[model samples]
Target: MTDLVVPAVINLDVPGPVISRHLYGHFAEHLGRCVYGGLYVGEDSDLPNAGGIRLDVVEALRALDVPNLRWPGGCFADEYHWMDGVGPRDRRPVMVNTHWGGVEESNHFGTHEFMALCELLGAEPYISGNVGSGTVREMSDWVEYLTRDGDSPMVRLRRANGREEPWRVKFWGLGNEAWGCGGHMRAEQYAAEARRFGTYCRDHGGNRLYRVAAGANGDDYAWTETLMKQLGDLGCAHRPAPFMQALSFHHYTVPGSWEDKGDATVFDTDDHYRTMVAAARVDELLTGHSNVMDCYDPGRNVGLVLDEWGTWWNVEPGTNPGFLYQQNTLRDALVAALHFDVFHRHADRLVMANIAQTVNVLQAVILTDPDTGALVLTPTYHVFEMNKGHQDAASLRVDLPAGLPSREVGRASLTTVSLSASRRDGRVLVSLSNLDAAEAVDVELDLRGGAVADVRARVLTAGRLQDHNTPAAPDVVAPRPHEVSATGSGLRVPLPAHSFVTVEGRLA
Candidate 1:
């Protein structure tokens, strides 16, 4: 057998950007049961609920301190007409969600319901407007209805609909996938449309909206360059151009193409390794996109918003194909950890990232059974819970040892280990992920500016790569206490195979 490799050393130091808590955000689309059964069970249902939303899910999300929630659509947003969702629920219009499932939307869970949910979860509401199928007036009026406090036609309608106080909505997307589902518009065309629509998405009362342009999908560098260049030109001429607080980018980690996204829970070690490799590609995407953004806006005034991201696989068998629901397994937990690490490392450029999605949808953190009223937190959820301490913490510079081994599955390859570190509340927290399917890693930590006073760790791992929590066994992959010991000027810790670990220590 090959001799065990020397422990990898990581040197941690102070002085870095604070990881934005918004990076821990979530996405809720009107796809599958995500909005309906997943989040809303109706007020009259037998299941316990707050207003029309399920209380259990609310409490779980509240515990996560979910920073922000992007709503209404993936493709559904551009097709959505804000007017259809307001007013009396009984009188609301019903429309077909042709983009997601072919099911009819009751319109009961409209603007008010969404804002109410955001209020309940203590999360900022990020609304995506309709540019493909909606006019500028409609988008502007919708913003007015939600944020306006003074007398206005939209405010009057809001009051007539029973809401006396306006809701504070700060983040707004100009459109979703304008190059594709949103409308087959060219980058130049979409940029012009965004400018026109953003001109009317005015700040009302105390609410100042951060407008995000419809950005590139994956590594479509040209899309980012074109939009940024055009918008940059407009800014130079107009002084302060409309909207443009951020430019949105959507990337999902699928082993294969969209036509065959592979299975969620049935993958072997090879497939799992490939998935990890794909997830690591987010770093490349962010770097390329950021480089393009730098060329136009070298001052970095604008941020990058990863509005929609996460694993997308073939739907659970027998489920509606269009719903886009899939199981979350140990593999997903690693994928999440990988992305979170990347997001934290680049917190300076990233404003927010909404995992796609929250419940009963693609790589959801939580899953629910409508018939049995059962709820389960996936392995991905545990990763989020353990890493919550990193939110808003100062991201520390970590010097990882070079020459780490790279494991390969066919053409795909990934470093055996991934990590990120932060300092908060007089303590240093380090997150580590071991992507190897076999071989636990021995890691050494070198604390530069401070010494470790006390250390504690939490780890999420399972017996099998495919292990996941079903309703019958919800704690199958939950986090458990991990042991760490001081060694010389650092600490030594063992990271189990295919695991996500977070270690926290009081600094001296």
Candidate 2:
């Protein structure tokens, strides 16, 4: 018997909130190659593309069942002029990407291109309107141009631009980060802007817009408090999205200080441990923000959207620093799993959460070298793929003993084990993360409610803590069949250290 053990009981009968597939959402910014090269390889390029959008990238994101894609900008959204991206590709005006690398923006992947990209991936389009530097008219016109049908000015403009029917764009962001790169506005001030922008950015035709207000930064409870009190409050108890359907928050797990966010490929155990501890902080932030929301909107009608959350490591060596590019590793995969565990636990209030990026920037799932058409799925990609079953599944609480296991890193102690479960389509899905850097832990999982049979499992693990996939060796850290032993009352699942595992079986 191993000294390190996790005894968990998954209650099958008790039902919990259904996990939103949008919780597995993705973000694509105009930063770095994420747009120009990563997702778009140009119409004339030799790489396979549909209307200039990379087909390989679309296929890869499609494999993950990507729920929705937030586009056009991060900081760029505030400075982005939607008009500059429409019309003929060459005739479109260009601007400088001041937020990322000070590179010139061709405005090629604008409103029309993004809609096409989303269609190819079968994902919903979540556009962040320019609220910081852009006017309410611009945001409203863009909304009308995308969703309004028939012969209006915006509709005429849309038809002239080549797309005949209006695209149904529901999820709209009022802004990015109003306190920072977005606009440098206070919570109260931004709330006013959100209300005004959301008002004019109306539901055209039958397309009702789900406007998302730019929300608090990490743990900025006052910001959330202010937004709910000012924007979300309908002068009553929990009005259902009076002005804004959701509020957005951005949090990234930077392993170290912003000056040095730890290296992507090179890091000591202490660095790795700290990253895990920081990754787990999302739960605390979620709880804090949720608690504040409960105070203002008890009915939880105003959903919380974590529009930006992921690891923000130092840019890869020799790469453009402002691009926020970094490699994903086994540790990064573990970070994603920890966030998902928390996301499932708070499924009732949290509607959607998009990783900082989908490709080539920050913690991207798919990295592509556009010049060579080389694309590799990061370790984080595998975690998303393995747990796709949990999307829209009923959350099942994982009850574990108080004293499970722990590892100390400085003042904080990392819980070496974490797990979450959900059920859908008559099957139970379980995800377990063993954070111990050296020893694998055996989990004695007790299955309750009704009997489960034909238990199967797969794991994402690597030899080294920093093991990652590159184009040359893309399969270095991929999921493979994992062994599951049937126990008297449950199952014995061995979770390797610094790894993530998911098990599934039909409920009888």
TM-score of each: 0.96, 0.98
Query: Could you tell me the TM-score of candidate 1?
Result: 0.96
The residue-level lDDT of candidate 1 at 44 comes to 94
Cα RMSD (Å) per model? 2.1, 1.3
| Prediction-by-prediction clash tally | 0, 0
- Candidate 2 residues 1-508, lDDT tens each? 3566789998898879999999999999999889888998889988899988989889989999999999886899999999999999989998999988899999988899899999999999999999999999999999989998888999999999998998898999999999899889999899899889988888888898898999988989999988888744543555654568889898999878989888888987888889989999999999999998888888888899999999998888888888888898998999999999999999999999999899999889999865567999999999999999999999998888655788788999899898999999899999999988888898998888787888889999999988999888999999999998988888889988788999999998
Model 1: ten consecutive residues of lowest lDDT? 1-10
Instruction: Please list the residue runs of candidate 2 whose C-alpha ends up more than 4 Å from where it truly belongs after superposition.
Output: 232-236
RMSD of 1: 2.1
lDDT of 1 at 493: 72
